[model samples]
Target: MPRSAREPGRATVQVTNHRLARLPDVQSQEVAPRTTPGSGPVVDVEQAEAALVEHYPRLVRLAYLVLPPGLGRTRRVLTAHALVQRALPRRRASASVIPAQAAGGTDGGGEDPGYSLLRLQVLRTALEAGRPPKRTAWPRRSQLPPLFPQVWGLKLFPRSGGAEELALDQQLSALSGPARAAYVLRGLERLPEDHVRKVLSAAGVTRPTAALREASRVPRQDALLESPEFDPCSLQARPTDLMRRRQHTKAALAAAGAAVVCGVLLAVPSGGWGPDGAAAPGYAQNPAARAALDPAKVTKVPPTAWRTSARTDFSVWPARGGLTGDTALLRRALAVWSRPGGSVQVSATPGTPSGAPAGPPQLLYAGRVDAARVVIFYDGLRLARYAEPARGTDGAALDFARVDAATGAEAEAVVLGRADGNVRYLTAPWVTKAAERDLLEPSAEAVDLGLQDGVTAPLAGPAEATGSCSSWNVLQLTEGSGIRLLTDLGELTPAHLTVGRPGAPGEASEPEALRTWSPFACSLAAVRSQGVRSVNAWEFARQTLPDGSGSAAWVCTRADTWRGDGPRVLAQFQTPGGRYGAVAAKAEGVTACGTKDPHVLAGVLWKSAEGRWYLLAAGSSDTGSIRATGGVTGSADGNLLAVRAAQGAQAGLKGTLEDGRTISGLR
Candidate 1:
């Protein structure tokens, strides 16, 4: 078997930075105090506060420099200020044994023990802020986003600099939290490698040497650290989406005026307003809710708008259907969405909010599907469906799913109806063809489904499959550029499927891509109603069997959701001649096997055809080494490992990257 031919790339640095930003803040633990050989000078609260006040700007800049740059400039700035403001100790504490930074630097605060202590406190909390929050502990004050010192309606960021500064910022962003601290201390504080190591260790870095080594990769540009680009104290303010803010203000004023008028008319003095069919009683005082239910206020885009629109998403999708002009049906749909009655069946995809719309939603469809009157609505963040018996409002159903930021093929189609073991889709105006194909039979030809007014013909939906999992149906939509596969996930929207490596995934229409999906097609059932946006399959490694039986491929499939939080990851192994891939391991809501963090580790216990058992594990190509612990203990170079073991054996796996960092396997 061949080792992964893929070369190591710089993406790991960016990925590491992304993973560090989302890490939960260390809650329950304080920064280990950096003690000197002898008892250090004790600094009182007054002295600390005095140091903080006199050198507030420089201290904030230091904190900002030390903090992870992935936090975004605005958050980093606010966090820096908050950390510096809170650096004053609650009680007397021993000052840092390390001496003050070099002279001739603008950032240098006097050699006051108080200043030293404040610097340590700021450095400690900033580093802690980058760490993941512990599950068993409560969050420390510094770990949470700063509530005070927030500037409303404005985004503050340091002044922009030239290409040199930009390049430096990008390089710094690639470094880990401790590495960033080391670089900042060395460049900004004029601390030598030895003193920087001491400060980093005192600040709780487990491996200061590795951090310094990583920091050394960035070229020395200490003078650039003094530029305004890195200075949080000198900030430029910009209004946040001024046009959107104005529109919201206008909407608020209009709603208020309408509420007053409606209140006067509905103040019956005896009984409240008349019944709102299948909807919860409306509160006369809630103007936003009232306005959202108005049929006339519903946004309707022109039919030809998509042809000329720059943005390609639901926002550009024009309203269509026979009853688009029917106000009565539209009113019923809006009312039901706001507050479905007890008799109405309501369902929502995971992480999707079923609450009333904040404003008038855009109309996507309003007409009939089979024996039911159906309507679809989009409100920027979510897609909502309302359906009832064609005869009357009886047996109404409302369903919601998150669809934020959907674009291209992802927003290409949506489910319109499901009845009699078949599903129908309402595709975007851009779709030129629609078809259905069995995923289990990758080589099978696609059956074309007629499209009338962008509505796809009824086809067997995989979501409704039960009993034997013999056949899995997936919808195929084709536009000018290429084709895409979307499968019913028991939600109002279908999840798109792609094949390739992370970040650079392509359409799963090619023969190779189709074959890659055939084995694990049934695994799609695991992510039903998960608000899945898209799923990507990537083959990370190929390992030769230790007993010379054959080689096997290790592939990872990840289902990314619309809410962007919960992702389902599955590691599967397929022997050379096997028809289906076996699930080696799986996990949910993990950063591993994701676009941001493309690396994954998984292990499986396999019994050879000759009756010998083994423990096999694999990681991404960048993995330098793998070591199995627990039930079966073995170590191997590179990402692939095969160790003889008993049947059904259990083991824990950890991988060391080419860099010194170690990562645990996906459970």
Candidate 2:
């Protein structure tokens, strides 16, 4: 019979025999059709499997060329091997109908036998030959498959298109799992979207909506730039594609630059001088000075002046020595010698122990001596002296001097035995005629020393002398001395002569007396004595009397003194009511302690009459004890004290000069 009239199964055998005779002896395998009838024409499963195996190595080589350099060939081969294995099952299932489907005409109806089984075999063979194993052994240098055009382009033009290659890799990375697989299959591999979705579903990436949103939002530019393997110029693209890529790059760079600038600005200081410039508060102004002060041995504060008395007194000397006692004559002299435009006005208030109001300040004394000197003394020891050689008599200027009795030496006594016995010699430069007149006449209240508590009451007589001697209302006597003052009324002694009530016997109502005393009686010559109507009477005092013959003396005195022409009294003292004579003995060793005015004593040198030096600290409270040398140091809230002993010196013991060393302990 003719081939067309043969059995349906035999027809497929005839075609295969004819094709095998014409073709070369290529290795091939035959596969039996599955029993599931009406599915499609039977196909050779063994042949499809053999074809996939043969082409996998070449596919892996192609994938390796498109991938990053760091992913070794071995890894690429493994990936391709896995992909081929996965594809095999699908290919085998479809192989039965693949050849028949290709050969069948469109006009064939569903019910008709579509194509001969032998025709399906021929089609399958052609497809296998086209994708031979060797085709993927090396990367294709020609047009790349649509799946990874950008990556292929970069390989073709490395330097110019590398950025585009990177961008494509970035795009893939940015896509959600479902979208990434869909894109790889549809856009990259030219698979239909529906087929790509199927592949994604099989891979378990089912969320299609969320994947689409993420893919649209996150830009690929940042990822591309960060990736070392990506190159833009090497990527093959149309003009529009290149422009889009450039815009994305520019936006990313701008953002990065702004972030860097903001970071830098935030790192700088907000206010005041920066590094390498002027320092903050308490730092020295000069660079060299600051460096030296880094390990500073001394720090000095500026001097602060305080008016520390109520009825300030100053001593005045006669410009010529023998001036008339007439008030008018003294006034005329004062007017001529007064500061060019300055006038002297004085007033008096009630004396201590009696609240009697005194007359106003007067032009007691004022006058110019030589061209450079002008002196004014109001009250008694409260003095204001001005010496300015460069300034003319009428020039507007101020040259003030304060006489600190605590620090100043008394004028040497004149010998009354050989000269006039009743006449006292005027020593130092005497106050000018103007100064005397300006001081004596009463005017308005001239100064207010802002005294706290009560006025100082006068004490009478003399006894033992110890502890500190001051002119304020309060006295800080030693323990024994304080007890004596409270018990014995007649033991206290005024430093100067007494001036009683106006109507009392032998009473002239003289000005108040001001004096300084030595608690240890080391020397009586250094103590200051004077007379004035008003006194501050509230000054603070500190005393460091000798503990023994060899011990040092120290004292805390006012830091500043009054500046006036007359004998200026810097400090004063008075005894309490019903008390007489000095309380303590005139021993060689004694010490006293007390607090001082916070403002005036802020910055002064404190030297004890016994010869010890101390710096008067500001705002220190009165405490009456010495820091023990052999024990720990101590301090009050406002002040600190340090003690040091001589080398190998025991507590309360004295050491020789050469063998002595200091052990400083601070409070």
Candidate achieving the largest TM-score: 1
Q: List the residue pairs that clash in candidate 1.
A: 23-132, 24-131, 24-132, 24-133, 25-133
Cα RMSDs of all predictions? Answer: 22.4, 46.6
Candidate number of the best lDDT: 1
TM-score of each: 0.59, 0.17
lDDT of 1 by residue, 66-141 (tens): 8887788898899999999888897668887887675565557757788888888899999998887899999887
The C-alpha local distance difference test score for the whole of candidate 1 amounts to 0.80
Query: Which ranges of candidate 1 are over 4 A from the true structure?
Result: 1-275, 283-288, 463-468
Output the TM-score of candidate 2: 0.17
- Candidate 2 residues 54-111, lDDT tens each? 4434323223223333333233233333333434442224223322112222221212
Against the true structure, candidate 1 reaches a TM-score of 0.59
Model 1 — which ten-residue stretch has the worst lDDT?
10-19
Q: Each prediction's Cα lDDT score?
A: 0.80, 0.25
Model 1 sits at a Cα RMSD from the real structure of 22.4
Cα error of candidate 1 at position 510, Å: 1.5
| Model 2: residue 235 alpha-carbon error in angstroms | 18
